[model samples]
Target: MNRTAQPAGTPVRSVPSKFRGPFVRWPRIADATLALAMFVAVTSLEEGPGDSLVVRPVVDLPPAVLLLFAAAGAALYWRRHKPLAVLSVALAAWAPMLGSSYANVGGIVIVALYSAGRHTQDRRWGPLGVVAAVGAVTLDGLLLSLPAGEIGFGCLVMLGAWYMGRRLRLRSERAAQLRQEQAAEAQRIAAEERTHIARELHDVVAHRVSMMTVQAGAARMVAAEDPQGALEAMTAVEEAGRQALDELRHLLGVLRPKAERDGLGPQPGLTDLPRLVAQVREAGLDVSLTDDIRAPLPARVELSVYRIVQEALTNVLKHSGPHTRTEVRLGHDQCGPGISIEVLDDGQGAALQSVSGTARTTGMGGHGIVGMRERALLLGGTLDAGPRPGGGFRLTAHLPVQPVLGEPA
Candidate 1:
C-alpha cells in the first residue's frame, strides 16, 4: 500500500458545511439573514451632490426600481437550491439599474456567482453560469458607456468568488475519498489478524487433544493386563486435559474486549521447551532436544519458533507411532545471520507406512504443516518438510534475525 506523508505538525482540516451540501444549519434563517444584509447595504448607498459617477439615494429612486432591487435581494434566499435561477434573476434586475443611479447592484451578482459554483451538481453548468454572468456584466457596462476599468474590476471580483467556492468543493471530495480508503484498509487488517488467531488456536488445541486421545486409548488397552500402568495413563490424560484448558483460556483472552479481559499468562518460549518435552515424554513419545542458541531473540520471533516446534511435534505424535524416536535441534546458523531448526524421526514403529502414506496422500495432515509454514514465513523464514530418503520424516526451518538497536550484531 502507498501512503502520502503529511507534513510534521500539520493539523487535519475537516470539510466545511458549505461544501458538504446545498444547505447548512438552519438554512432558511441563514439565507434570510444574508438577503436582509445585502438589501440594507444596497439601500444605504447614496451619491453625493458633486459625485461624477451616476449613483442615487434610496429615498430618491422610483418605487418600481426599489421593488426590482428588493426582488433581486429576495431571490438569494433560494440560492442554495436554485443558484443559476437566482443569478439570472439578479442579473436581469441589475440590467435595468445600469446607467441609472443604482447601477451598484453588483454585490447581489457576486453572492449568486459563488452559490452557483459551490452548489451546482453538474460540472458543466457551473462554468457556463460563470461565463454568462461575466458576459452580462461586460455587455451592460459597454452599452451604458461605463469605464473599461470598472467593468474589468467587477468581472474579476465575481470570478474570484466563484473560483474560491469551486476550489473548496474539490477539496471536500478528496477528503471524503481518503476517509473511505482508510476505512477499507482498517477492515482488511482486522480480517488478517482474525485468521492468524484462529491458526494459533488450532495448533494449541490439536496437540493437547491428540495427547489425551492417545493416553485414553492406551489406558483402555492395559486396564486388564496391568492395573498400575493403566492408572498412570489415565493420570497423564487428566494432566493433558488441564494443560489444554489453560492454553485455550490464555489464547481466548485475546478475543475479548480490552476492558473485559484480565491479565494473561506469558506465551511459551524457548525456556518452556523443557516442560513441553517432558509432557511429550509422558505421552509415550521418545524425544530429545539440543538447544545451542547463544543470544536471546525478540519476543515475537521466540513465540513463532516455539509454535513451529510445537506443531511439528504434534504432527509426529499424530502420524508416527508413540515408540518412534524423534530429535529436535535448535541453533544459530553457522553460515548466515539466522536461526536453524530441525525435527527428525526414525521410521522404526509399526505406523511408519501409514505416516509415509498420509504424507504422500494428504500433504502432512491438512492444516498442520501449512500452519507451521505460515508461522515461519511471517518471521522472514523458510520451512521444508518431507519424508527422508533413509526412511523417516524430516522438517527443517531457517529464520532470519535482525539485531536490535544499540546491540552488537
Candidate 2:
C-alpha cells in the first residue's frame, strides 16, 4: 500500500487511523465473527410480546423458522463481498419469519441493509433494497393485522438502516477518490522536482564542459607555435574537468535517500562566487566580479544568484566574440531589503539573440533563462535577461531577503 503525500487541508477520516490497519488486514475474519454473534442472538428469541413485531402470534411455531433464521445469519458472512445477494437471501429468510415467534432475524435484516449500503457496487441497489425491505415489512404487518402506525414504524426503521449503509458507502468512495487525487498531485510535484534537478545539471555541467572543450581546442591549436600557451590551456581544461566532476557528484548526491546523504557535503552558494569567477577567467574570457553584500543569505537565494551569474558567463564563453569582456555585480539593494545581481558582457549581442527568438523574455524560450526565471519566481523574486542598449548582453536578478531579526542586514 503506497502512501501519498497529501497537501495541506486535504481531508482525513474521522475514524482513528489505528483501527484501519486491523480492519483492512482481517476484514473477512471480523465479518464472520459478527455473523456468528448475530446468529446466536437471533436463535435465543422465544415467544414474548417484544419477541415478534407480528402482534398476535400464539400457537406452536414450526421448526422451519429456525432454519430461516440460520440462513439469514449465514448470509452475513458474504455481506460485504456480495451485498445485494446477501441482503436478498437475508430478506427471503426474513419474510417467512414474520408470522412466527422467531422474528429476531430482524437484526440480521438491519445489518444486511447497512452492508448493502456500505459495500454495494451499483449505486441503484441501495434504493431498490430500501423498497424491497419496506414491502417485506409492510406485508408482514398485513399478515399479522398490525395497525398503520406499527407498519409505518417498521418501514421507517428499515429505511433508516438502508440510508445509513448508503451513507457509509458514499463516504468510503469519496475517501478513495481523495486518495487517488492526492497520489496524482504527489506524482506531479515529483516530476517538477526532477525537471528542476535536470535543469541544474545542465546549467552546471554544460557550462564547465563548454569551457573544457574550448580550452582543449585552444591547447591543440597552440601546441606547436606556443608551448607555454598550450600548457596553460591544458591546465585550464584539467581544472574545468575537475570542477565539472565535483558539481556532478554534488547534484547526484540528492538522488540518495535522505538518511544516506548525511556526509555528501553542502551545496555551493554565493560565498563561492570568487572561485567560480576565477575559473571563468582562466577559460580565456575577460571576466571580473564585484561583491559588496557581506550578509549571509538564504541557501536557495544564494544558489539562484550563483547560477544566474554562471549561466550568463557561460553564454559569454560559448557564443560571444573572442574580445568579449564581462562584469558581474552582486550587492544588497539599498532601495529595498533584497539582493541584486547583474551580469553584463560586451559579447556582440549574439547570446541574447540566440535565446530571444521572439524578442521577449516572457516566453521562457530557452531552458537556461526559463530555469533561472522559475527559480526567481519561486522565491518571490524577478529576473531580466537580454541585449543591452549599447553593444552587449545583460542579465539581472533580484531576490527579496529578510535578514534574521536582531542580526546584521
Candidate 3:
C-alpha cells in the first residue's frame, strides 16, 4: 500500500513510537488472517463466465481467479502501513476478472479502504472505484445483452461491507484521540498545581529565612558583651532557619510525580504551648498563659490553639514595644463544643505595627497572622482580631474540637 508519510501534521509518530505503534502499525497475524478469509470467501462466491456459459474444461470453467485473490489477501498485511501499494495490488488482482460474468467475491478491498480512509476522510473512493468498475463490467455484459440485476447486487454487497468497516475504524480512532487528550489535560493540571505551591513557599519561607538571618546577625553583634544571652539567641535563630529549610524541602519534593512528603513533621498542638511560651520568654518577652480544658481534645483542635497562640505572641514581639505586657487565655468545657484562644497585649491596640515588615496584619502582605486564621478555618473555627473593648489589642480564635467525619446521622 501507499506508505506515503503524512506531512508533519500527521498524528503518526515518525518512527513508530508509543504514540503511533498500536494505532497505525498493522499486526502481521491479524492482517494475514483477514486477508486469507476475505480472499477465500469472496473468490468462492464468483462464478466464472465459462461456468455460466457451460464451457468445457472444469479448470477453465471459471477464471483463474483464486490465484489473484490469494495475492490480494496476502497484501492485506501491509495495507495500513503502505496504503497506495496495497490499493494497487488489490486493483491489479480484481481488474482482469471484471470482464467475466463473476469477479472475485471476497470483500478484501473494503478492509484496505477502511484503513486508508481512517487516515484521510476520502474513504468513499474505495467503494466508488468498485462501483465504477462494476458499472463498466455491467456495460460490457450489456454489449452481449446479459443480465444486470445480479451484477448490481454483488457490487452493493461489497459497498455494504466497506461501510461497516469504516464505521468500526472511525470509532477506534476517536477513542484513541480522547485518551491522548485526557492524558495531556491531566499533565497540565499537575503542572499548574506545582507552580501555585512553589509560589506559596517563596512567599512564606523567604520571610522566615530573612527573619532568622537578621536574628543571627543581631546575636553575633552582641556576643562579646553578653555571651550566654547571645548563645541562646543564636540557637533560636538556628532552630528557626532549620524549620524553614525543612518546609522548603517538603515543597520541592512535591514537584516529583511520585515522591511523597513526610509533611513538616507533626503539627504543633496545645501541649507545645509551654515550650512556645518559653521560646518567646527567652527572647525577652514577659508572657502569662492560662489554660482550662478538662476533657480530651481532638488533635486538630489542639493544633489550631497552638497556632493561634504562636502567631499572637509572634505578633506581640513584632508589634508590641519592648516593655509591652502579654497575656494568653485558653479554655474549653463539655458544653463549649470547641476551644477558644484569647491573646491580649497592652501595646499596639490593633494598629499592629509592620514591625520591620515581619508580621502581616489583617489588611497587609504579611502571612503570619493570616496563617493563624487559616488554621482556625480549617478546624471549622472563627478568628477575631482588633482592639479590645476596654484597652489593649486582642486576637481571639474559637475552633471546633469534635470532628464531624462520619456518615450523616
Candidate 4:
C-alpha cells in the first residue's frame, strides 16, 4: 500500500511546562527583570558627558517623554506571547525615542523585530516586519538628519535578525517532518514481521496434522480384518502426533516474549528430509528422495527448502490416488546459478485435479501454494506448481544461492 503518513522517523512531542527550565517556566518574570535593568542603565547615564562613547541626551526629555521610553522597553515582556503586538507598540513609540536621541532604546526595537520573525506563527508577519523596518529607517533619516549609509546599515541589521529567525523556524519544521517519516517506517517493519511469523506457523501445523488425519483413518478402516496392520497404523499415528507436537512447541517457543522463553531449539533443515519422507511413508505413501549438491546451504535457504518439500509431500498424501508414486529431486546446476527442487507424483490425475480445484477455492485454499511462493521470493527465488504434461503433478522451485553457496561446481 502507498504510505499516507511519514515513514522512518519519530513523532515530535511538545515539551511539558514542568521541564522548561526555571527561566522559561516564568517568562514574564524574566522579561520584567530585563526591562528593569534597561530602565536603570538608561536613567543612570551622565547628562554632562563630553564627546565620549556614552550617547548624551540630544534634548532634555520631560517626564512624559521619559515615560514613553520606559513604556517601550517594558513592552518587550510580551514579545514571545504577543510578538506582533509588542512590535507594533515599539514602532508607535519609535519616533519619540529617536527624536529624543535615546539611542539605547533602539536596542529594544531590534530585539522586538527579532522576536516577531522568530515566534509569530502567522505568515502576514513577514511583510509586516519588513514594513516596520522600512518605516523606522525613514523616520530616523528624516527626523535625525542621519546619513544614508547609517540608516541603510541600521535597516540591514534589523532585516538580518529577522532573516536568522525565519531560517531557524524552517529548520525546526524540517526536523519534525523527518521524525514523522521515521515513525512510519518502524510501524511498517513491525507489520511485515508479524506476517512472516504467521506464514511459518501455517507451514509447521498443516503438514503434520494432514498426515495424522490420513494415518488415523487408515487404522480405523482395517482394525478388525487385519489386527497387525491396524496396530502398525496406530503406531504411525502416535509418531506423527508426537512430531507435530514437538515442532509446534519449538515454533511457539520462538514466538514467546523474550523474557518468558528459555531459548530456541534447532529449526528443520534440508537434512531432515529423510525423517520427513519416512513419516509420510508411514501413512502408506511411497516417496523417494534424490540429492546431488554436496555443498552446505545457508540456514534460511535450507529452511525454505525443507518447508517446501514438506508441504508438497503433505498435499500428495492428502489428495493423490491409491497407487501414486512420488519422487523428490534436489540439485544445483553446474552451468547456472542457485539450487533447484522438484516434487513429481504419478497418480491418477487426482493430485493435479486437487491443485486446480484448490486454486479456485476462496480463502481456505491456495494458502499452501502462497506460503511456498513467499518463502522462495524472500530468498530471490521462483516457484511453479501445476499438472505435469504427461500424467502427474509437479512442483518446482529455483532459489538463488550465489550469495550463500558461492561459486557453483
Candidate 5:
C-alpha cells in the first residue's frame, strides 16, 4: 500500500475519535453495503423471527425489521471513531426488540467488533464480548422469545471474529517491538566503531605526519647548498614514508580484515618545516624562521601545528606571487602555560591593504583558513589565520602543554 506509516511492525492506531475519522471508515462503509446487498438479493431468507421479535421482553427490536434499520445504522458505522458511542446508539435504537432470539441486528455488531479491534491491530476487546453475546442470546431465546439454536449460532459467530482480530493485533505489536530493538542496536554498534577508528587514526597518523614534515623541510634545504647533507634528510623522509605506510597498513588490517585489498596512504607531517621553507625558497621566495621549542610537545598538538603551517605556507606560495618575506616563529611561552606557533607573510594581505589604501586587495583564502582551523581544533588547540597588522597574512596556533590522549584525568 502507498502508506506513510513505518513498514516494520505494529502501526500506530488511527481510531475514529471525536476529532477525526479513521482511515478505514470508507472501506468499512463499503463492507456494510456489500453485506446488506447480499441480504437483499437473498429475499427468500427474509424469514427471521418476526413474530417472536414482537412479543420479546428485553431489547424490543422486531427481528424482521432489524436488518433495514441496521443498514441505516451502518452509514454511521463507518465513523467507528467513537466506537462505544456508535455501538451504543445502534444498540439503544433497537433496545426494545433485543428480546428476540434471532436478533438480525447482530450484523452491525459484528462490524463494530471488527472496528473496535482494528485500532490496536485487533489486540483488545475482552472476552466480555463472548459472555455478553452468549448471555444475551440464551436469555433472549429462553426467557423472552427466540429459538435456542438460533441464539447459540449467532453468539458463536460474533465471538469468533472478535477473537481473530485480537490475535492479529497482538502479533503485530510484537513484530513492531522487535524491529525497533534491532534498529537501536545497529546504531549503537556503528557509533562505537567510528569512535574506535578515530582513536586509531589519531594515534598513528598524527605522529607519523608530524615527523615527516620536519624531515621533508630539512631535505629540501641542503639539496642545493649542501647536496650530500640534503640527501641524508631525503633519506629520513623516505624512511618516515615507509614506516608510516607499514603502520597504516597494519592498523587498517586490524580495523578491517578485508582491507588488504586497498593500498596505503601518503606520508606527510610538521617536522618537514625546513624543507617546506626550502621548497618555497626554491620557487623564489624569502622565508625566515625563529624556532626555540625546548619542551617536548604532544603528538596531536605537534601534528596539528605542522598542518596549519603547511597549509598556510601553501596559500602563501600559491597567492603571494612576489615582494614578500615569510617569517615563521615557533616558541614555548607561558600564555597560560602553552606553546604557540605563528607564521606571517609581509605580502599584499587583504586586511592590511584595505587599511593602507583606498584600493582593494586580492582574495587570498576561503577554504585554506578553515582547513588550518579544523586541524588545530582536532588536536585540542586553537588557530587564528587572518591578515597581519603590518602588510601581510598571519596564521597562528596555540597548543596546551599536555597531550590530550595521555593527560591525567
Candidate 6:
C-alpha cells in the first residue's frame, strides 16, 4: 500500500481505507471492553450501615443503580468522536456513586478526559475538560468531608493524565512538520539535478551531431566529381560519430551511482579549443581562433567556457552554413577580473536568412542559447548573443576566475 506524503498541519485520518475491515472495528471493541470494566467496578460495591462504606457482591446492587453505572461506562464508546459531550454524560451518570463505597470509577473519568485532550480539534476544549473534571471531583470530595490534601492530589492526577495526552499530540505535530521539511528539500534538489543533467546532455550531443550531419551531406554532394575529397568528408563524419559516442559514455558514467562508476574521463576545457577550431575548419567553415588568457581558471569556469563556445560555433554551423566566415577569441576582460569570450560569424548563407526570418517573426533564441545563458548565470556571470551591427551574429560571455567554494578547483 502506497501513501502520498501529507503536508504539514494536514489532519491525518485515524484509520486508512485499506485497513477498514478488522482494524476499523478494533477501537469500538476496545472502548466496549473499557466500559464493561468500569461498569463492573462500580456495581461491585455496597454500603454496610449508616455512615459505613464497604464492598459487597454485584448481586446486592439495585437495578436502577446498575443501569446508571452501565450508562456512565457506555458513554465512553463515543469519546473519540464527541469527547466533551461524552465526558459530561459520564460525570452525570456517575454522580450517584460520588459518596458511596465504590471502587473509584475515576478510571472512566480519566479515559474521557484524556480522549478529550488528545482528539479535540479546538485547543480550548482540552483545558476546559480538565477544569470541569477537576471541579466535579473537588465538589464531590468537599461534600464527602474528604481531606484537602487528598482532594488536591486527585485533581493533580487528572490534570497529569490530560497533560500527557496533550503532550503526545504536540510531539506528533512536530514530527510531521520535520518530515514535510525534509521531503520538500529532497524534491528541490532532485529538480536541480535533473536540470543539470539535461544541460550536459544537450551540450555533449548537439555539436557533434551537427558536425556529422554537415560532413555526411558534403560527402554525398562531392562523391562523383572529387573521390578523394568525398573520402575525407566521410572520414570527418566517422570521427564526429566516434567523439559523440565517447562523450555520451563519459556522461553516462558520471550519472551512474558513485560505487559503480570508475575511470571516467575529465570534461573538455580551454586547452581543447584549438582541436575544436580545427574540426570546424575541416567541416569547411572559415574559422579562426586567438587565445590570450593569462591566468589559470577553475574547472567549472573552464567547462562552462568550453560548452558556451561549442554551442555558439554549433549554432553558426547550423544557421550560417559551412562556408560562412567565423572567428573565436578568448582573453581576460579588461574591465573586470574574469575571462571574456566572443564568437562572431558573418550571416550570409541561405540557412542564416531562414533562421533570422523566423526569429524576426517570433522573438526567441533556440534552447542551445538558453542553456548557454543558464550556465553563465549559475556561475554568477553573464552572456549576450545577438546579431551584430553590420551583417553577422555575435556571442559574448564573461566568467569570473575565482572558483565557487565547495566545488572542485
Best candidate (score: TM-score): 2
Give the range of the ten consecutive residues with the poorest summed lDDT in model 6. Answer: 1-10
Write one digit per residue (lDDT tens) for candidate 2, span 1-409.
1112332233322111344553468989988888888887777645456545333332344668767767889899998889899888988888766764466577788889988888876878778878988888888788778899998998999999888878877888887786576445644655676688889989889999999999999999999999999999999999999999988887877754343366766666877889888877777778888998888887777777877777767667755634468889999987899988888877553233464322232222134554565567777887666555555666778898864346443
Q: How does each model score on lDDT?
A: 0.73, 0.72, 0.62, 0.69, 0.57, 0.74
Per-residue lDDT of candidate 6, residues 241-354 (tens digit): 999999998899886534236766677799998888888788778889999996888999998988888777777777777888998999998888998888888777545456
Quote model 4's TM-score.
0.47
Quality of model 4 by C-alpha lDDT: 0.69
Q: How many clashes show up per model?
A: 0, 0, 12, 10, 23, 0
Q: If ranked by lDDT, best first, what sequence of candidates would result?
A: 6, 1, 2, 4, 3, 5
- Candidate 3 lowest-lDDT run of ten: 1-10
lDDT of 5 by residue, 186-259 (tens): 34444555677899988988788888899789878777899888888888878888988888878887753231
Candidate 1 residue-wise lDDT, 70-123, digit = tens:
988999999988988888888888887776657667889889988887777667
TM-scores, all models, native as reference: 0.48, 0.51, 0.44, 0.47, 0.44, 0.51
Candidate 2 has its poorest 10 consecutive residues by lDDT at 1-10
Per-residue lDDT tens digits for candidate 3, residues 1-409, read: 0001111222321122334453346566666667777765664454445544232333543446657767787888787677546766776676676655445433565566555544345555665655644554465456546577765665565566556656776887886675465444434444555578778788769888888888888898999999987898889898998889877776666642221244545657777899998888886677898988767777767766876787678767766645567999888734668777888777643343544321222223234444455567677777666554344566777778776585121
Which of the predicted structures, 1 or 2, would earn the higher TM-score when compared with the native?
2
